[model samples]
Target: MPVTDVTTDPEALTMTLVAEFAAPPERVWQAFTHPRELARFWGPPGWPATFTEFDLSVGGRVAYYMTSPKGERAPGAWEFLAIEQPHRFEVLDSFTDERGDPVEGLPSMRTTYEFTAVDGGTRMTNVTYFASNEALEQIVAMGAVEGSTMAMNQLDLVLEGLREYAQGKGTQTELLSDTHVRITRLIEGPRELVWRAHTDPELMKKWMLGPDGWRMSICEVDPTAGGQYRFEWEPVGDTEGEAFGFDGETVLVDPPRRMVTTEHMTGTDYPSTMNDLSLVEEHGVTLVTVLIEYPDRDTRDAVLATGMTEGMEASFARLEREVMG
Candidate 1:
């Protein structure tokens, strides 16, 4: 199986997370359905999970409790609706009270987990449905999306580790969080040098990937509010690549200081997720902060799972060389 892709639509209040695991669908199914295996990798890093009850059947109930490092505990329960062994499952997940009773009036989410064979492994998708768009919006605004993405990334690590362990390769997978992969590099060069590297077409070509099929095409930027920019990452050789392009609307443009862009990826054709870049000077060092806002947690998680931190580090290193030279 290949890497998974996760995405969300905040306006629609929906999220979809897809991943490919190096295991058969049945194995993956067992990992998700079995209480003992599920408890081991269910929560975010440092969060301990205990499954009080898990009934893997339609009309049955599954309940669990999670305690953070600080000793605070949160309980949740789920009612299974459809259960097809090793292939698909549907359930309604909700918060529970101390007595193990479901909390009334709180949002209960409907979730469907689907598994399919791809290559020699399994392709799994987790789709969560909220009651209403308003509820979805509220949760996203509260950062649930980002937090969930982090959790899924942790799940990826767990699944990968399990696969390796099954093959007698390693002991366990290392737990990782979103912050671990986020990039924050302090630059010593002037702001203009940094800005030019990001904005200038010639300089961008040296670093950024181009569009599919076309080797190198035109790169343009308006650099002002309401302005647009284009990015292309072309394919090499015979293999076809997903077209890499975005038409972004500039929301903020404070040259030598900050630039904010709202970009919509081509496939979704949705509103732009916000990207904010800020340059601040402290004791002669310029700190660059790149903030990207996605539609939901799943989308953010998918990006983080990809080795984004390493990629950013390399790109910044190249930028450093270009600016210093």
Candidate 2:
């Protein structure tokens, strides 16, 4: 759906904006409540916001600063006046000094944020109130309308990212132990669709590439327990025989639920890994957890340090589009 409006009424001393996001209400709420998530898209296109303090309860204060590319900074704060979980909240928004304290003699605004769950996503309505028409005009002259529209556009991107995450398009990597590294994602789609993506060769080829130009060239899956599988990859324009690939032996298999395998990369000096893939269905979403056991802590750390997580996230994002589409 389109934005309803972003209008400022100087007579009423109010400024309001409206937008919709392709995410659930709770997901949209988290984008506001979670500090790290809020920082991702809380400002205009160039000036990005960084939060030093974020507390969502009533009477709590949130402090942040927006840093421009030319090294300028604008500090601000929001004192939460009321909160109603995933539905609504009200805050007193103000200008702040470098120390995160409100600046004296500066006008502040009271803002109410209302979130409504819609059929396909969430509708966000924001209303800001100033003490006087002059105060509203002052901020309006500061490009509040344009800046907020840009910020909300960024929020649209953030909500799209969150939607993918909610559909299992995001990846989480952590050290389960000194030798075990766990990577997990809650993927949207049915269990069989997820299973096919894992086991079917053609579907695997669709999303198994690391970057844009790379390709998963050879995929073979003999999906039973004790079966063997191989996946080979190369740059799209590769002319040489050199290719990066992996082979594995399935140790256990349970359709749409669990699969255990030993993964051995063919061209790497790194240690082979044992992966336990578990898929559980809850509310029509499949939670896919992959626990990978490296030979030692050093090997696991080395893998992590390679910055492979970004590639995994990119790959999974494509996977969601391929499967869910």
Candidate 3:
């Protein structure tokens, strides 16, 4: 497979990959829309794979299990949001259990794949949404960006293999920006508990917020559009830090459904950070997504360089422990 263009803007944590495959739109579409075909190239290489339940309709689900080389098996699921044969398919992807249950405190992302017909082939593009800029960075640090690129490349290989088996000429594969991080996780807990962990200041302090030295002076939420919120984090360590504060203006706040906030730090003159949270309930479990958008590439790169990814993963792990207990 040949990649025509692969562009990655680490600041926006966005990646665009453009590739032309030798097959027509229908063939490419079948490879993606069909669950059996998808499982062949969906995960990292050398992982044992199995599909549990596959329903291709809107609101339907596709669940599968993958066992690593060490014999550790993990289950994952995807909820179909939209499916247009031979053109586009959108789904919410996450890691789940054998019974199709979501785990706790992990982010679930929205993934959309589009197929277009070219002169003699098909063009495919994949767009993924993360919960927060921090979450995206964390996934990048964990190598999701590279893993996904590899997965896509493997998809190209699968296409070529299919062509070979069918006695057709093999084509190619490509990438646009390969910088974006693919974030997906399973959160296992009741909706109300997860809601409390998010909105209740005391509870949030226990998990979402950092420890004693970096305490939050104020954490108030109106839970409505045009509502106001202020969160201040002060450092206590001996090391000279950025020595700044954090603030955000709420743009959209719909309780237990979704919330969007524009965040600004004290030193950074620009209100460059956008935070988005979404919550859903499945079989009594609550799944949440937190998306953070930065002002530009520089700020995004700076934050990534500061080990923010590990910090976020720790915070989320704390939240899971607190809630699951």
Candidate 4:
């Protein structure tokens, strides 16, 4: 187990858990900063977590929910209090209502995380301070310790990069949580071309077509934050489906590296999805990563069941062959 020991103190009304990972502090810290990486180990076994929003700065808050096997949800929020690079951070952690407001009846805790470099690995000292002994006992009685142990143990797999979709391969999808999926693809071209292929309407229209019988009829892109992008595709001939399009607004953008958008169907009652796209170049190849968040588990399942991954693979293959080349 990554978690070596857990201790509780009634006098101080605090609980502390010590965990060691065979990873550096910087790598371990990245797991917390990246929402997709954090979601993999944030919930206990049998309950998967979904983080809809992540604000990494001090005084910023994050909203997340863990869904039980029976479809029950436990919402939570975290307000960052302090951050010291890759060494330490603190947060006010609380159980919240579905709207992400802290519940009046639940006890919130002041949690501190300290990461130290020890023996070429990192030791994380996690401490949660409660208001009173009763609050401490209340949380312990809820099996918080055991659940946390399980959750932390799962972090070893994440640190090992065991869950990365496909390495040195085409488009591949990995389920990060009940409502989140990550797709990655390595393009054998420069990073600039990859970015242009996504943002430039002329380039997007060439390779964004899903299958052989479909053609992109409309490709309007606005890459600035708060701007909108609309893409539509139609069956060329002898193709099987009606025309479809997607419209989305840019939530954030860092040219050549990252972009975020909230996407909705051009004409449908379907729930909207948040997509975080990032590009990283190593050596001569560029890797494109997309983390997608669905509204709920049902919506996630329905979307994935529609052959979304395969369609994405087809588009990415076209991008490599036709656009990036």
* Cα lDDT for residue 182, candidate 2: 60
The lDDT, on a scale of 0 to 1, for candidate 3 is 0.63
lDDT per residue as tens, model 4, 167-273: 55667777767777878787778888999998999999889887789999988989998899998999977889999999989887778976778889988988899
lDDT of 1: 0.66
Residues 155-234, candidate 3: write the lDDT tens digits: 66456553232222111111112222223233556767777777777887776544334655567655556666666655
Best by TM-score: 4
lDDT of each: 0.66, 0.79, 0.63, 0.85
lDDT of 2 by residue, 1-325 (tens): 2366899887787999998888888999999999877886687644567798887889999999986533468999999999999999999999999987788877988999999999888899999999998888888889898778767765664565534444534788866468766676777777788888989898989997766778887898899878999999887664443578889888777688667788888766666788877665655777676767788888888878977788788787788888667
Quality of model 4 by C-alpha lDDT = 0.85
The root-mean-square deviation over C-alpha atoms between each candidate and the true structure, in angstroms, is: 16.1, 15.2, 17.2, 8.7
Candidate 1 lDDT by residue in tens digits, 1-325: 1335667776666778787777889888988888876775576433446799888778999989876433457898989999888899999988899888877766778989999998968888888888798767665675665556555554443455422322322111222333222234666566777777777878876655422233435578888768888776566688575546666777776687667777776556555566666554544545555656666666667766776565566566556565545
Superposed model 4: Cα runs more than 4 Å off: 1-165
Q: Could you tell me every candidate's TM-score relative to the true structure?
A: 0.49, 0.51, 0.47, 0.59
So what's the TM-score on candidate 4? Answer: 0.59
